[model samples]
Target: MEIDDLTPAETRVWRAFATGTPVDFRATDDEDPSDGGAWGAERTVRAHVLRALLLDGPRAEGEVPALNLAGVRVTGVLELQYATVDHPLRLRHCHFEDVPRLYGARLREVNLSESVLPGLISHAVRVEGVLRLTRARFAGMVRLGGAEVTGSLYLESTRIQAPDTEGPVLQLNQAVLGADLWAPGLVARGEVRLDGARVAGTVNLTDAVLDRPGGTALKAETLAAESDVLLRDAEVLGRLELRGARIPGRLDLSHARLANPGGTALRASSCVIGELWLRQGPMVEGVLNLRRTQVDVLFLEPEVVPAWVQLNDLTYTSLIPHEPAERRLPMLEKGDSYLPFVYEQLTASYRRIGDDDAARSVQLAKQRRYRRTLPWYGRLWGHLQDVTVGYGFRPLRAGGWLLSLLAVGSAAYGLHHPPPLKPAESPDFNPVFYTLDLLLPVISFGQENAFAPEGGYQTLAYVLIITGWILATTVIAGLTRTVSRQ
Candidate 1:
């Protein structure tokens, strides 16, 4: 277009683009555009005019061409689909008439910080430099699926509210980021999906607020992050699904609030994480699932313990705080379903930390949980084993039981002696020897075979024999199980 064909605002923007100078329409940097009545023709730029200047613009001999305009009202859709523009685009604090479509567009540094737009579609686009949307407000969806960003993608203090839309408000699914995905203080009214996203650097969403009640707040399933995925101090009013995600660094959600009552609050099942920190008393109002999640170090403090959890097949090498089993056992009991492996894993974890007594306590708790699933007869037998030996976790209990039974039997028989069946064959009728002979099922003292008790004394002798067999059998089974575990 000729110079005479351009308007005053267009002429200034075109002239500044050649020298890479930023044109600020606002009176001051902090000037509120909404407070003004309207944007006049001098502050308005057509999207097609901006596109034309970006695609083919005259530049000074030693200057790089760029379209840096601030506080301008961009009219019409900025359609640069499948276009390759090498110039840096900085449209800070600009107001857009429609969502800019950059589908499959390759660009350099693009900063739309503090802009007010309906939406942005940059799917399959490649950005060589950073893409900043800091403090930007989007009233609709922002789709960046399958995009590649060499530098970090910053969304600091960005707010996206798509209340009428059922789809994700901010979709970054399957995107590959060479650097970090920094989105601290982001507020999304709908779902924010990062499914299958691979980030070379950290995925930080600290202080973000995601509100998609009864639906997914953040869905990052199968996401692979080289560095930590920090969601610290986030407020999620829906499900935070991170199933099958693999993070080499920590996945810290400390001090976050996850509320999806009667539904899953945070499901990280099948995840492989280096350090999974859910400490600092995060409020989880729903089921916290860690089923099949494998973490190297899990920092789960007592204050953050959820009432309902799914811990089946969850494996953690080290538990932080290293608290006693008494404190951690309540966490294992939160699951509704009986999972023996969870108990075994907890027991192993305690043992690894050289807390043998705590480990034994976990084992005892495991037996108690297992007993609830058995039939009446099986439960009866379990009670016997538990009372007498503490399921072999407390070996001293077995000795105490043995000593008590011995004293009871010796006292009962010492009051009255049974008449000897063969007076000449039997040795002196000793009450202690007679009691030992009846109590010890395998060992015989020769007194039981020689003496024949009648009436109530005979019935007491039968009770002693049966009780001896039960104690001997239970002790052997418990000892064998304990030894095998060791």
Candidate 2:
């Protein structure tokens, strides 16, 4: 391992290291000097280049390093652990045919820009300082689980290819970051898992595109952020779960395309935030489950209307199986101004479930909530006062005009035909038929007791007078007085 007894190329590489100059394979325009003739011949020059960096000490600053392994064939593990670099580490146009390990490596103030890292494994990679990947592309699978970073982690315009499984393309499970995590314009062909990851600052995924199948586009849980969890204009082909995450500031999913097979659930249970905006892209296929999620000020805080109002637009085709009604109502109620919208959506959902009563109840509750805001002639206007003293009560209104017409017709018939007088011997009036007799007019064609002609005419005259008085009273009452209490 002595520098003096090494080969000429190795001596030159050592000299470049000592002199703080650039050490790149492309600089020499030949294969790495470490790849001897007796060792594996098919081994790639890039492998030797990586081996030199791993085994070597700290690299000097301002080194124009480049490792172009565009088509190099490799079959073994490429370890680059504990390597410190002050300059940018360029692996542009490189292709890893197999999985490569770079675990526990400290990439401090380095740039891996415009590189293609296929199947790169960086498990437990402690990035203490800033690591920039402006336009790097990842072809196969990549794992960044349990990685911790103290500085800003920038991945702007990065592309991550989808893996064959239903899992995420880039898994950042249980990772912790001390600074802001920026990934604007980041495109992922597969899902992204950041479950239990904690970021002290904002977790920005603005303009990021995440495309996947029926699986979730982002599966993050317990993500505690001090600032906003910004996902503005981020397109998610599958569900986006922020379940059990705590966001101190706003949770902005504005203008994001969130597509789920049935629906998407942005469950942020037990989390506190200022606002939750589902206002941008509301054409969600499923319910936006915010079960037990707590918001401080505003919920369903939409930036615009009509275009971003699809929480209740789900049809019967999107209905799922039965869930507990009590449990579901709270989730729908968590959003502030969107409570009405949520209730409306839930009503539709309940209707799809064949629970019409529940749906009606939800509608009634909404009406009651905004009853005071209604016009003076509205149905709920003065509802409470009307209930207290029986004001504005109208049973006839319920029966409509048909009952009134019937009452009028009965009165007309009674006026035309007066009831007959009972015999003088019969003193008592039959109480059962008395009301009916009063209502109908009895027409007399001939006189009774013809033997007494004077008496019959006199009785007929009295009867006519009495009938006239009764008819007049009935007409006056029917016209002047109201029939029944509502």
Candidate 3:
């Protein structure tokens, strides 16, 4: 391109690109035209002119090629679809009249920090270097789906208030990043999706404020991250879903406030996480669902326990803090529905930590919950077992019942002796031996069969026999269950 045909600002940018010199159009560092402040023709560069300099520019000898322009107004859409450019594109603190389209373009690096644009569409683009959009503000959708970044993707302190759309406002689905996704202090007014995205390093979103109520705020289902996904101190007003995710490092949500009342605040169902730390206490206003999820270590010490949870089939190897069964049992009680497997999982977790008493309590609670689903007669039987033996968890209660019944039987029989079954043939009858014979159905002292009781004494004898049989049967059933579990 001839320099004679170029505008003053365009000529300056073209000459600077050949030697990789940055062009700053602002008269002062405080001058920011990003708020729609008009810039004169001397501070404007046509997109076609910039494109020509990027694709067909004449470079100086031994000088690198770069389009580094600042505080300039970019006119028209800078379409670079399927184009291969080796230069770095830096348009910092600039204003764009239209969204730049880089669909399927291959570039070295791109930095649009501190700029204001309607949106950006770089779908399927490949960047060998980092892609930085720090402090940039967008008013429409930012699509980067299927993009592969060799270096990190930075969105630090950026504000994106996207127009209403069917898809997420910031779409990065299926994108693969070589390094971390550093987006601390991000403020997105719409949904941010990372579905199927794979990050080699961590995905940090600390202090972010995502406000897309009645919908998913950050949907990262099946997101595989090598390091941690930190959302510490974030405030997400919608659902923060991570279903089917595989995070080798921790998914820390400490001090975060998630609010999606009457809906799922956090849904991590079917995920396989290394460690999930919800400690230092997060406030979840809705249901926290972890159904079918498997985590190596789960640290759940929320500030306020969720009113409802879905923990069916969730398997965690370890639980943090090792609180007693009383504290943890409340979590199971808040389940959406009765899940026997959840109680068993807690029981096993307590047992692994060498808390036998806690394990027993969890098991007993499981039986009580299970009893609610039975018929009236079955529930009545369950109540008997619970009152007598604590559903087999409190085996010592059986001994107490036996001792009390024996005392009652002995006092009644000692008050009035029965006639001998055969005169002069039966041995001398003893009240203690006679009560023992009547109480133990299988074991006899030959006292009950050798004597005869009439009227009220006969009725007392019948009662003792029936009560003894019930106690014996319950004890045997309870013991069998306990042994099998062991």
**What C-alpha lDDT do the candidate models reach, one value each?**
0.90, 0.56, 0.91
- Kindly list the per-residue Cα lDDT of model 3 for residues 246-343, writing each as its tens digit: 99899988888989998999999999999997867556899899999999999898354688989999999999878889889989988867899999
Tell me the lDDT of model 2 at 353.
62
Give the Cα-based TM-score of candidate 3 against the true structure. 0.93
Top-TM-score structure, candidate number = 1
Q: What lDDT is reached at residue 99 by model 1?
A: 91
TM-score of each: 0.94, 0.57, 0.93
Worst 10 residues of 2 by lDDT: 444-453
lDDT of 3: 0.91
Q: Which segments of model 2 are wrong by more than 4 Å?
A: 1-15, 19-44, 57-77, 81-98, 299-486
Candidate 1 at residue 32, lDDT? 59
- Let me know the TM-score candidate 2 reaches against the reference structure: 0.57
Poorest 10 consecutive residues by lDDT, candidate 1: 31-40
- Candidate 1 vs 2: which has more TM-score: 1
